[model samples]
Target chain A: MITLTLLLISLLNGGLAALIFFRGLKNKANFFFFLTLVATFFWIFGLGMFRMSSFENGIYWATLFYISASFCITYFLYFALFFDNKNIGKINFLNHLLIHSPNIITIIILLANFHFIKDYSLEPWGKSIKLGPAYFFYVTHIVSYMGYAIFAIIKRFRNVSGIEKTQLKFIVFGTITASIFALAFNLFLPFYTYQFVWIGPYSLIIMVVAITYAITKHHLMGIKTITSEILVGLLLSILFVNIFFNDNNLWFKIIIFLVAILIGYFLIRSVFKEVRQREHIEKLMKMRSEFLDIASHQLKTPISVIMGTASMFREGSIGKLPKEQQKKFVENIYRKSVKLSGIVRDILSASEFDTEKFSLPEGRLEPVDLEKLLIKIKDDSKEEADEKGLELNFIKTRAKISPIISDEFYLTQAIANIVDNAIKYTKAGRIDIMLDEDEKEVIVKVKDTGVGIPNEDKSRMFGKFERARNARDMYTDGSGLGLFISKEIIDAHSEASIKFNSEENKGTEFIITFQT
Target chain B: MAKILLIEDDNDQILLYHTVFKMNGFNIISAIDGKIGLDRAKNEHPDLIILDLNMEEMSGEEVIKRLKKNPETKNIPVIILTNMDKRKFQSQMLELGAEYFWEKTVVMPPDVVKKVRDFLEKNKIK
Candidate 1:
């Protein structure tokens, strides 16, 4: 029964070590933990064989077990040191040699058939599991390395939080518990009561379980992205193959295989889904900050214009001039204040539109005359056009026109937005507002002969807070939300769409068609 | 009197800055945009420039880059006079050979005239 138990423990260690070590091959910290697990499997296998062997060769097997134990302890120590990477300030080559000397010396002695074990006796346990001059050396080696690992882990735990703290806690508790069991079964029980030496190898399985749980459950390893699925998938496949060979019952093997494959598929899919979501969220965060920068940069100009002009009049920078001069400056300040208010209103509307909350309360649409609306829009923008030395034109294609059913306020703002944009962009030539009606649609066209939109900027002209590359150079006062708000209002009508055609350095023509 | 060429697009600002600088006993010749500013810089050969950051056909950055490249205007010192908050481009504008950065909204027009007067008195040509 003891031999059977030992083989099972050996197989468990081997399977876990193969999976993790395969996944951990590229990483230094994980590779050290893999070495520790591999050594534990070798120790358990050699000890199990020693129990079933004759007295003459049992000593050799016992020697092999001791050599493997030394290697296991050494590997666990190195694993603890390299685990967090932040704790390793300076890697001393000499200290490494000192820590490893015991393992190297023991393997050499065991190979030479030296006096670490002079001979063996076949008691019920069938081996002198812990008896040698170097026995004390092995004890000190395991105890000291475990002490060092505990110290390193505790030091690292204080500085970490979140998932790393949880992972390190598991590793620390597992290392301490495994060390105590090793001491009780191998050293204390064998000397004080002379039994339970066969049980020592089984306790090593606890350390293996703890490390494996950390890897699979907590994802303690920061894996390489875009290829993490392949590695984890390969590891699961190896585990399935191991189960295929180990189980004796054919029905049990097939049932377990199907269940594992089903669970594994979902696990990998969820991990991929989570990774992609995180990547997308990070991109949005970056864009949001950039949008804020542009918004603040654009909004500051109008605010400064209002404040600067107001103060210029207050300080009498224009001197004690005629009443006409003072009146013009006051009008300039009033105009700038209105522009600032417009910027703030557009910003609020754009933000509301972005969140999909901008809507008319209800039943706001009304019937309106198209000719009268176009005339109002042209009249409102005529003063602005004259101020810039540009002609504003309104052309009636027909003497009379049909009226369209629409939201009057939104319709007025939409047409006004198009005409305002035309005047703003046109520094020299005339801006013409032409009205034409077909059988099914009424179209309002705005054409400008100023600085036209660049081809690159035209595609994104209707995007919120988007402006042409050279638009700011032309006029620094625009908030970049006029065209976007116009687009939104037209879309809300559900019967109209705004389209534009432009050539760089020549002109642009915007056409708004409303379905009748 | 030091000839100061003020390049700005706003009408009110041009009238204000011209009145202030002229009263401070400096010769003030101004343009409304960057392209005209560059043309006048070469033709008039002013002793100093007051450049605005915003304009219609060309940017102030482009204007300064061309001014520094041209042999005729490379030696004159430039003072930036606009509503732009200077923290974003103060060091870079100085490196581009602008001698001072004055935010237009914060400083009084007379205060700006005083600063320009002090600068000219300190670095006046022999």
Candidate 2:
């Protein structure tokens, strides 16, 4: 009964460790967890050997398993610390070595055949070891290490909320239950009575089951796909084991093995593909909701302006006797309507990028005059810059610049977006829109003496709906899709590229280059 | 006539509010940005200030915080007229001692004048 139970515990722990390690190979927490379970597996299996061995050999097996127990407790502590994606570098190497010093010293004493265990005596029920001077050391080591693991988890539990809090909750419950029972049955109870030593190993099942539940239910390590994958793998392994034990001929066995291998490969592949698709769909849903949030705010402003101005005209509330005032109100409505349409067009253009079959629309490509296009952008952005009391300059090249074959509408929109961003971010300094060219390329550089992009924000600047922290604080109304849409539009044009150089609190320069 | 300060960066919004307030027989002074708005609030001593949140040089929140901190401009009621989500800023604005937090898109210019008129009457600010 003892042998079979130990074998079951070892198998269970080994399987779990393998599954978690394989699925989350890159995660430090998973790696430490793998070590913890492997240590537990070794300790339990060693305990079984200690039970079956003779008096002399029983002492050796006892010492070996005690060493494994020490490692098991230490690894459990490491796993708890590393869990929740905490970076390993946070605990420096010297501190790590300091943490494991006691374990290391205990391992050395056990290996050197010190007075850790005085003797081993065989009895009717089981074999047990007599306590030595180092026995107190071993007991203290196990109790304190296990206690600290639980304590660390409880400490982390207070700082977290939501899913992480729940994840930590299960870990705390499992580790505390398993540690208490294991200490009572395996560590303390064994000193007084040997009858319940086996119960300590069985208590580990509670820990395993709790963590497995957490993994399958919560997004612990982002491996919720582990459940089905492990099931399919276990089922296939059982089929392979059954084939090996069959009374079939050698050739029959070989053929069955080949077919099983082929089936298993495709089954796992399909499961992986399905999980990936589900994750992708989930990401799209999150993006759509975020889009709607910003869309409502941006779209509402212009609509509000149009509706408010138009309503005042309609109601004639203050008695509109002056024709000049009426004309101004009419113009405001027209301007706001045009602004509303422009916002809607930007949103539509941004959504088009989400579709898989998206490409620049045909027949929209035409030879666009660089000078004419740029002057229009300057004229359009002048009112906004002038309102902020900043000079907007368009410096034309001395040499005549030729036009490029491109989508005239999108190209203009992309360039205009850059200039608009410049005006938005800048407070006082002048924005210089300089057009220059060489034999290979035509370049338009929009430079501003505004608050420049931070180093951390530069890489993700062109990502959809991603705004820098400073930018978000500075301007609350930006949808953060301007640069993303601009990049896409520029990339759509063959041999065209957009790049920028920015220094925080200094300025930013965006250069768009086109093939002549 | 109550001297009203309109602190908005948008020209069209400024125009709409300016014309409405003028027609309603209120003396309206306008500032193009938050910095100018703060200066006007302290210097002009307007009875009520209509502030826009997002601006280039300074923000409306900063303006309000400064106004409430200074003795000269602290008593004047500030009305936040913004295109931002009202739910996110309504409580925050009120906590900062703003008299009213109104979404620009939701309230008409005439409605804003009436709100201002009602607030001035209730507060007994001449």
Candidate 3:
């Protein structure tokens, strides 16, 4: 009965350790836990078999039991010493040597038949071994390790306050309960009366329950993802353990093994796939938030200027000046308005792509009036050219031009972007616009005598977030989105295209062809 | 006269503000960005600061954090004037010890000056 109970406890403990090993391999504490549990499994399994075996079989089982017990005690000390992830224990090489010396020596003595236990007899449910001369020394060494673990845990408990204290509460309860029961059965009762060694292993199950509850429920030791993995691992453990311990035919066992391996491989692969996908999603979310921050700031800068100038005009601050000075303020507000509206449209366009909401309002796309659009772009950008002490003018090269089918607002934006780029690049010369048309297409060209696009920059000049070398050097804060947005808007119409001709540091002209 | 330090980068907003604040006969100091703003705050010892949240060099949140940490400038009242969405940072700015928050898109130059005057009066009352 006692031997069977020990075997049951060993199986249960080993199952719990296997469950933790799924996704818990990254954690140091879990590694130590695996070591301690495996040692316990071997110790209990060997000891249980020893008590039920014949005399010759008893010696073989006893050898395994004693060796496994040494491993159990050594690893248990290591686990207790470093259970808390934050606390670095004072155990050194010398300390480790001192702690496990007695365990190592006793195991060697017992297994080598050097008489750590002279004789033993089966007591129906347990074993009775006649203690040798070295037995008292071994007891003191093991007891010291237990005392050391208890003292360390209590000291840590006293130092921590709040949630950590609560986690330690579980650990303290488990360690003390296991120790007291193990002592009562293995040491005190065995010396004075019949051995009840099976009681020690059973009480350890309570320790396992408390610690597992702490790990999963309280989130101690940061054991995340192990909960769901445990659910998957538990079912697999039962299935696999049954196949492992079954005394079936060799052919049946091999078939079961093959099937189990196939299922386990796919199960592990799926879990990792989920983990990778989650990490990728989190990275994308972080980048999107950063972009939004920059977008908000970009939108805010021009809006503040537009609103401030408009507010100034509304309050008669600019109108109170002479008519000559007053016209400049109105021009300033108009210039700010064009930049403000252009930025807003760009953001809206980009967000549609980002959020996958390609919802454009109906009837917004219509025949764009070529003459009025060019006049407005020239008027709005007049102040921008004047601010830089340059002349901006528009000329119609043809008597009549056909209107183009496009979104008027976006068409106005694309023309404004071309003119804005002219104003930005031209340092000391005039920006001129010439409009002409043939039977099939209407053309708009903006020419500037300023630093032109380099040969390398012209290819990706219209790509999103790409800027010319001189443009970025001249203006530090430009978003490089103006031309990109304009290109996207023009490209949406199948027959519209933009072309440019440039000589570096001399002059450049941009031509937009809209098929009527 | 309460010396007000206006930390803003936009040239048009700066011109509008200079006109408004000067018309009201209040002394004003302007810093174009956060790095200059922080330096001027420590050296000028302005009675109040008007801070814009987003800037090229350093952010207004970082400026406020440094100001609160420096004992010499920690007591000066702050008025947050920004065009960034106000709801996102209103409570956090208040908790960071800003005296008033105004969205520049909504508040006009006259009302902003009036707010400065009103905030000074209420602070005197407290």
Candidate 4:
């Protein structure tokens, strides 16, 4: 009876190991599944050897059992490492070696027992039988291996997450129940009896519960439902044959095989259909964003022209008119044009960028002197800067020319935008443009003693259509496209990157770095 | 006084521009559309061409290309006066050899006249 039970347990363990090993191949990173397979294989081997008629030899049976205990402890250690997400190098290698060392030592000791006792005897109980240890060392090895597994489990319990935690709990309870049953059987029976012979099957039942949770919830070891469904369909077809044919014939088997093949083909087709539907939805979303961008770009050009011309008219550079009349006309144009222009530009730029079609054209790049460019830009902006009563200063750090190869017009436009933004935001403080060059890159820093960007707004400062909350509340007239355009131009330049550091109520500094 | 040809489509805008240029002592000749403007350029042989980009019959770009192709009118400098933003239109017009590019909103009529005067002075046209 003992031999029959051992044979059945070994076959069950081998089947479970094979299933886990197949699943492990799908997600190569799943070390947990691989470790489980290792544990199951060892248990199958040890039990199969012990139940063999040739292993009625006492020492051989003891060695196999000891090897099985060692593998169990190794499997628990693997579970701990998988959950922690810690570097494998960080796990103490010496501790792992120490844990597995006892199995080999136990096998050696059990072999030595052959000198003392040649054969083992089976003691009988109620409907089951237990093997007695002829060697003393075999008893010590079993106790030590169990103790090590319990210690590793306690150490790992705190680190696991979600379903793994529940699985660990079940495993611990099952192990304890098995250990208690073993103790009870040994105390009640005469001779050195194998305690808790029923514990092996009960432990497997607990593992199956954990495995079921892992498959349904965590998808552990990548054991997906598709494979299980196929297995179930095969089993159901077999059952149908037995019921319909009472006494089985060749014709019944052929009918079941043909139906199973048809079902399998449809299941594969449905999975492909689901994938195609998901791709179609993604494509529609992409097209919608592109349409919006094109519309915005089309609207922006005319609005900018209207605003720019109005500002020029208000300045009275065209002809001499009465002072009072000119002032009133200028003020009206400025107020209305600025507001409308800001809205149009912001919306358009945001939409264009979203569509991902706003790309800079490749231009001939040549070395440009930073100081000369700054002087020209300063001259151009002087009138507007003076009108606001704000001082715009260009402070040159180097006497020599700091040259960078980039698209001259676009680079000038980028720098001009930053300067314009500073003047617009600052009320009375100075705006400074500083140029410096290092060994490999040229740096242009635009510093302003203006209403600095607040911390909350800093994160979204470069985002499309986003303005600082304070700027919005103050009713500042800005399209909020200057920085966005500047960023795009700089990013397109092979040698340039733009960054800034700002503090609330203090000031903001924008730094542009270009590869020399 | 310089004999300037102004090609524009909008009635109100053309009236305003005509009045402003007339007041500045320019001999203003007008065309309501690109076809008439091209006809006037061939017959009158104006000293300068003031072109509007957004027109109903023919676009400013198309007009400029046609004028550049004609040997008789190729020497006459074209000035782009449009309601389109400077950043978008300026670079393209400049590359096409437009002597001046002005955004009508940011540039008043007076500034346009001054720019024309400067161009004439630089080229020694008068």
* The candidate that achieves the highest lDDT relative to the unseen native structure: 2
lDDT of 4 by residue, A1-516 (tens): 454444445444444544454333443224554565456445544554454434345345545544554555455445444433334444477876775566556555545653323434554532223334533444554455445545655666776778778756765665456444443442233234444533454345345445544455554422333464446444544543343344467676677656754664465345435544666677757644543443343343344434544534655533465577456545544544654554455455556666784555555677777788988888767766787788999987777756777667767777887888787777787899998877887888999987889876898787554579766543323445678777887887776799899987678899999887
Worst 10 residues of 2 chain A by lDDT: A237-246
Ranking of models by TM-score: 2, 1, 3, 4
The CAPRI-style docking tier of model 1 reads: acceptable
Where in model 3 is the C-alpha error above 4 Å?
A85-103, A154-172, A215-516, B5-24, B28-78, B82-85, B92-99, B104-111, B121-126
**How displaced is residue B61 in candidate 3, in Å?**
8.8
Give the CAPRI class of candidate 3. Answer: acceptable
Residue A165, candidate 4: C-alpha displacement in angstroms: 6.3
Q: Candidate 1 residues A1-516, lDDT tens each? A: 787678667766765665565443666667887898898888888877777666787777777778888888889888878874634655689987887899888777767756565545555644564365766666777788877876776777787899778877767777778777877887657655435687777776677677667765775433433245445545555554455355477687677657765675566556656765776687768756766655675666555656665666677665576788778767777777766666676777778788884555358667788888888888877778998999899898977677777777767777787788888888798999999988888888999997899886898899766789778666764667789888888887757789999988798999999898
lDDT (C-alpha) at residue A98 in model 1: 85
**Per-prediction TM-score:** 0.56, 0.66, 0.54, 0.35
Which ranges of candidate 4 are over 4 A from the true structure? A1-33, A45-66, A81-89, A107-191, A194-199, A214-516, B1-126
Report the error of model 4 at residue A252, Å: 22
Kindly report which residue stretches of model 1 are placed more than 4 angstroms away from their true locations once superposed.
A1-225, A228-290, A317-319, A387-389, A402-409, A450-459, A468-479, A503-506, B23-25, B69-71, B124-126
**Model number with the top TM-score:** 2
> Residue-wise lDDT of candidate 1 within B67-124, one digit each (tens)?
9999999998899876665888778788899998887767767788888888888987
lDDT (10s digit) by residue, model 2, range A1-516: 575667567657766776665454566666777898898888887887787666678777777788888889988888777763374466788998987887888888887867876766777787867667887888998888888777777777787999777876776788789889989988888677766688898888898888878876776434535755566556555554454354668677667656865675566556667776887788879977878877897788778778888768777853565777677777778877877787787898888886753456778777888888999999988988987899999998856998888877888889998998999999888999999999899999999999899887899999888787778878877888889889998888888899999999899999999998
Choose 2 or 4, whichever is better by lDDT: 2
Candidate 2, superposed: residue stretches over 4 Å from native? A10-155, A176-203, A213-283, A306-338, A361-405, A422-463, A468-473, A495-516, B3-11, B29-107, B114-126
